[model samples]
Target: MALPTFTQRYEAGDAWLANSCAHPTLVQDVWAADMLAPIPSGEEWLVAEARLATGYPKLVRIRAEQRGPVLADPVMDALWWLVPLGAAEELADVRQLVVQAAGWCLNCPPTGWQVEGRMWITRPDGSGLLTDPAVLAAAFGPGGYRLATEASR
Candidate 1:
């Protein structure tokens, strides 16, 4: 069987995000992206947010596969990462990290589509893969932005 095309993969990811979050409808082959969608905390995923200053650098340190779903909000000057539920407590000590727990709602862009001045820095892959809290916390340091390659050297 031939591998799935980019559009197919994108649609799969889009479906996954919708089911995981707001379950927005698709019309005219275009996702609903004019407004932000609310993503609830707890159950399946927890959102870990950080200032753009810290978030960008952290991504550099974590492995691509481990980074998971991340949302970049230029207007808010923030980056949001989706991790497994309970990440909030594990990453609590990380100064720049704000791991949102149950009851919070995050305005997010639809997977593979930018909306409301927000875009996915690392869109969800439809595999239910979430960033590990320990890896995220390890990324936080006084050392500043260090590339993944530099970390090993």
Candidate 2:
């Protein structure tokens, strides 16, 4: 299926941002990569962003389940927002939103990725911090932003 327009996707709300606290450093790094150029014809690009405990962004591309044409390498599959080509202007706005959402998520405490139905914060050495119910509650309780589920989409 063709991806939704940038405005539609943005208006649909950020499921990843609503569910997890992305690391600020990582967000900055993704923004810094300046990968928002025009996508070549017949070439599809996937951009994924995550928040890490470490104050640095790691841009390693990994294998991901096929969604579109398999690009050279896939980035993180969880807690990631995909930006397609021809959305340069929207891309800038989305980056800012992601950064802001990461800030909000960070404020909630114990920031991390929500994967496999669990919330996990990562440590510098690639270890996951034990899940804290309190943190989870604060981040995803009543009045919290509800991430858009696939069914809803």
Candidate 3:
């Protein structure tokens, strides 16, 4: 079979949320503004779908099913009410905790998977402390693969 396109993943994730039949909240609206973006065509949609599939909520239950106990984050308890059974396996415990503690900072509704912190969004990749490639190289590492020495701080 052909590999599923990004829109397919996004639509799938969207269906998962829609199947839950939960109403969007004020927080969700704001978070959505910060968190979600239009699919921007096929490739972007696929990127988003992949992120959602591997992110906190998705990773949580998936870990629970394949690995063990879901770490149990308070935030997830709130978010879980909105998720469908189909995507339950992907949620990660720690990620839920982060979302619980910091997810609110998201400027948009939760739509796609994200791999960075809220600060990363507020500041963005090519601005503020993240402006310099060397700074990023040191903070995150070479080719964004390694962390830097203490002097960087």
Candidate 4:
């Protein structure tokens, strides 16, 4: 099934945020596109995707930093996928999916794209950090991923 689309407001803001957060070396290499761009020959890229508060999806791409040639660059190891918040049949299912995604991201070698302290769920209304596995499980558990105080902090 096709993943749900988030609202346009969320998309715009996310694009802006992604560009603003880009590493200094990648200032000219950043792009905000609906779909990921093809990696150029001899160039490495990192891709990350997530949904905004308005339920809009956003994708960020960054030029991967390379060292020596064979060494893996942790900052360049990227992943992109979507978990439809509206598609979950139960709270437990949502929690499970999130945990699994976070775990997968977190377990990658240190030379992999770091998600532990950087991943998050953003909305035009609010946002939540997804660094802690326990926090994710608790927030997405019985409460259904929306807590009143989680906005913009």
Which prediction has more favorable TM-score, 3 or 4?
A: 3
Model 4, 1-153: lDDT tens digits are 864355544444344323323242232232321222122211111222223321121111111111111111224342222232322233244423321222122111111122233332222111211123233334435543443354435
Per-residue lDDT of model 1, residues 16-131, tens digit only: 77676544453212345367767576767888889987689778778787778888988789998888888888888998998886757777666666877889888876888899
Question: Candidates sorted by TM-score, descending order?
Answer: 1, 3, 4, 2
Superposed on all Cα atoms, model 4 deviates from the true structure by an RMSD in Å of 16.3
Model 1 weakest lDDT span, ten residues long: 22-31
Query: Model 1 — TM-score against the truth?
Result: 0.84
**Candidate 4 lDDT score relative to the true structure:** 0.26
Model-by-model lDDT, in order? 0.76, 0.26, 0.26, 0.26
Q: In candidate 2, which residue pairs clash?
A: 22-51, 23-51, 62-74
Compute the lDDT of residue 129 as modeled in candidate 1. 87
RMSD of each: 3.0, 17.7, 15.7, 16.3
**TM-score versus the correct structure, for each prediction:** 0.84, 0.20, 0.25, 0.23
- Which predicted model would earn the best TM-score? 1
Compared with the true structure, model 4 gives a TM-score of: 0.23
**Model 3 Cα lDDT, one tens digit per residue, 40-140:** 21111111112222233333322121221111223333211122122222333222222122112222223343422311111111111111222211222
